[model samples]
Target: MTQQIRRVLVRSFEDIVIERVPAPVAQDDELLVRTTVVGVCGSDTHAAAGHHPFIDLPYRPGHEAVGVVVATGRGVGDFAPGDRVIVEPNLYCGRCPQCRSGRYNICQELKVFGCQTPGALADLFTIPARRVHRVPDGMTDLQAVLVEPLATPVHAVAKAGDLTGRTVAVLGAGPIGLLTVVAARHAGAARIAVTELLESKRARALRLGADVALPAGAPDLVDRAHEALGGPVDVVFDCVARGQSMAQATDMVAKGGHIVVVGVGAAGTTPVRLDLVQDREIRIEGTLMYTAEDYRTAMSLIASGAVDTAELVTATFPLEDAAMAFSASLDLEQVKVLVTADGAVGVDGR
Candidate 1:
């Protein structure tokens, strides 16, 4: 007899449903994981609302997840049943030039496990062993759940080069933007400023180590950000990636500085000041998901008490209530929302 599992699917705008499906088994070089916690990401919300540029509707919705291995497939030796692990989610072709150069995050044939393919939003899911990372013994589920999400910002900040004693601006204060504040602080940025439309998110950014937090809707946001940083910022991490935030970043960055686009914006052309780009020599770089190195760095940061995971995750729901979890994630005040499998419990019961 075949076993069954429950999976979450987004069928249309603000329409998510849980369906029962046949469970999968561990195949060659794969592991069958019993998901404990799955984070509802901003992308997941966007996709549900029909805004994400990449992810299509009618798909499973999970990428940042923590689970326990129940079975291991042929040739897998590093992990065994009962081992706690986190999913890396990025699926890439090894033969691509980007992969050959160790930048598989943007491989020519890249397909994310959760976004582009079926993911771990079910009671049990099978994934290649190589895409799973073992969680340290002391790390709590809350901390482990953040490993995948934090890795993205970790990779983005690395694109900014050396930040020691350098001023930085983050154009949003949602989960990714706040984590950028944490990553920049860890990278030794002398000062950091954040802009968000919500006053509560701005306060949260300050608590997360931003030196300055301003309203993103302010007409003089660029001026206020510069004044707060004492001058033009050396780098601007555009976590919003919208036309307004991009304009603000271009106006706030110092000449020759870097603008790392970290967020996923809606599909369409956004205007830019070409004259300023030509005169200032500003470098704009796009970053995608992360490699294993970033995952390791993020896990280490979590284990060492560098990231405050508890504060970021605002709510949780059982697997049967996955749709509710997504609804909670859409609230502007909520930072991170998670879903738990039956019999699974998150740290602090959050």
Candidate 2:
């Protein structure tokens, strides 16, 4: 293996370029993973195109990565050389009140892999021994890379408990939104409606079992969804996070229905119309990143084939062509574009 590894770093928006960074080192309680497939998330697109405010300069942007363990540091348990695993990415201070209370995802000092911390786009990366989850045996690296994004929808569904027989609407039939539709179906929602700007994504959503897929700026999106399901929706998983979708979510909810906001709200969009929710006496919720349980449940869904993820992987690119991967991810026909590296050691070692 080379001492220096290439990484996709973004020093400025529209200025993302690959560079050779020194390969990461591992210490006891850490594991060195040779990354394989990395999903280009919508957040990466937003950040790389200069839409988000939280990310800083010279950042390597990829959080959804799956790879094989090449070396495990001393004291690391339950893993060894050549184990296939997906990186959990969220690093938290265990001593924080949130972490102590079992809400590590919301720990005050949390830093996500590929966000505030170094991510898995490089040839080799290291993480706390606990942050690795073994990918199921014989799983394709494509399915492995989807674990992180898949977890987001799972967590959103979990947050909105007892959704059985409830009507659901997902605004934004993008990756997360489509996943939310799948999760809602798994939760036994009576009907699922998805909306998107792209006709191609909408068509894919229909194939993935959305009862209806709406145009992004549909004049009566909420009404149309309600009418399609024969009444106001019981839950609206607003995965677009933009004000328009949030507005539609507020309108789609029934009198006592829930609204779960799943998308990353770009830098400065504040949601409003509390009076509408207050009057309707609806439950509005905001979901952040996922927990370990969410990740596990997501992988289980994939392994069980409950989720037909074939339509989800709209495109793929090799590691060296990640810039092209990112470009493809922005295409109208793409739902997700993944960057992959060869897993030469996985089959024999796992």
Candidate 3:
């Protein structure tokens, strides 16, 4: 008899259901993880609404996750049952050109666990042992769930080169944007500013160490950010990724400074002004999912209490209420939404 487990499935646009599926068996060099907490990412919401270009319908949609190792397959040596771990969702083909060049995040045949394949939103899921990292002792499952998303900003900030004493601006106060502010501060930035559409998120930006928080639609947003930073910011991270925000980043960044595109726009395309980039010699870079090094750095930052993952979580629901959790994530006021499995352990009461 096959073991069964409950999992969340995206049946269609705006339609989600909890279905009982066969428990996945760990292959050699893999581990079976019993899901604890799974954070609902913006991409998950997009995928649910049929907005994500890469994700297809009738899929399991979760990547940011923390779970316990319940079983290890043959040949697995590093991890054992009962070890708490965070999942690094990227699955890359080691032989790809990009992977061979040390850029596996952009592998020629990269497949993300949640987007392109099965994910960990289920009660029991199997992933390669190399993709699972042990969570530090004393860390709650809630905090461990954040390590995956936080690794994104860790990668984005690192892409901006040395940030010490430089002024930075992050456009958007969503989870990734707000976390960018924290990463900038951690990198010894002299000043950090965040532009957000929601007032509550602007306040949260300040609380997260932003020196200035301005509304996204402010007529003088670029000017105000420059003034706050004592001049044009050395780097502008466009976390919103909308065409308007992308245009705003080009305008806000200092001449010869860098602009990092961190967010994925709803339309999946942006009309950028090449003249500005050419004339100013501004460096525009695009970042995707985090690398293994970024994951390690993110875990260390979380372990050291440098990044506050708990504050980012605004609400939680049981796996049965995943649809409700996805709906809650649509609210701009909410930062991060999580779905918990039955009997899942957390910092607070389960």
- Best candidate per lDDT, number? 1
Better of 1 and 2 by TM-score: 1
lDDT of 2 at 252: 82
Candidate 3 has which clashing residue pairs, if any? none
Q: After superposition, how far is residue 139 of candidate 2 from its true place, in Å?
A: 1.6
User: How do the residues 30-99 of candidate 2 rate in per-residue lDDT, one tens digit apiece?
Assistant: 9988888899888887777777666666678778988888887788987988888888888899998999
Tens digit of per-residue lDDT, candidate 1, span 1-350: 55667777888756777776777889999999999999999998888888888888778978998999999999887789999999999898999899999999999998988888888888888899999999999999989999998999999999999999999999999899999999999999999999999999999999989998999999999899989999898999999998998999899999999999999977999888888888999999999979999999999888889888767989999988888888888799999999988633233222
Query: Which consecutive 10 residues in model 1 have the weakest lDDT in total?
Result: 341-350
Best candidate (score: TM-score) = 1
Off-target runs (Cα >4 Å) in candidate 3 are 343-350
lDDT of 2: 0.83
Separate clash counts for every candidate: 0, 0, 0
lDDT of each: 0.89, 0.83, 0.88
TM-score of model 3 vs. true structure: 0.96
Score residue 316 of candidate 3 by CA lDDT: 96
In the range 283-350, model 3's lDDT, one tens digit per residue, is: 99999989889988888888888777656999999998999999999988999999998633232111
All-Cα superposition RMSD per candidate: 3.6, 3.5, 3.5
Q: Tell me the lDDT of candidate 3.
A: 0.88
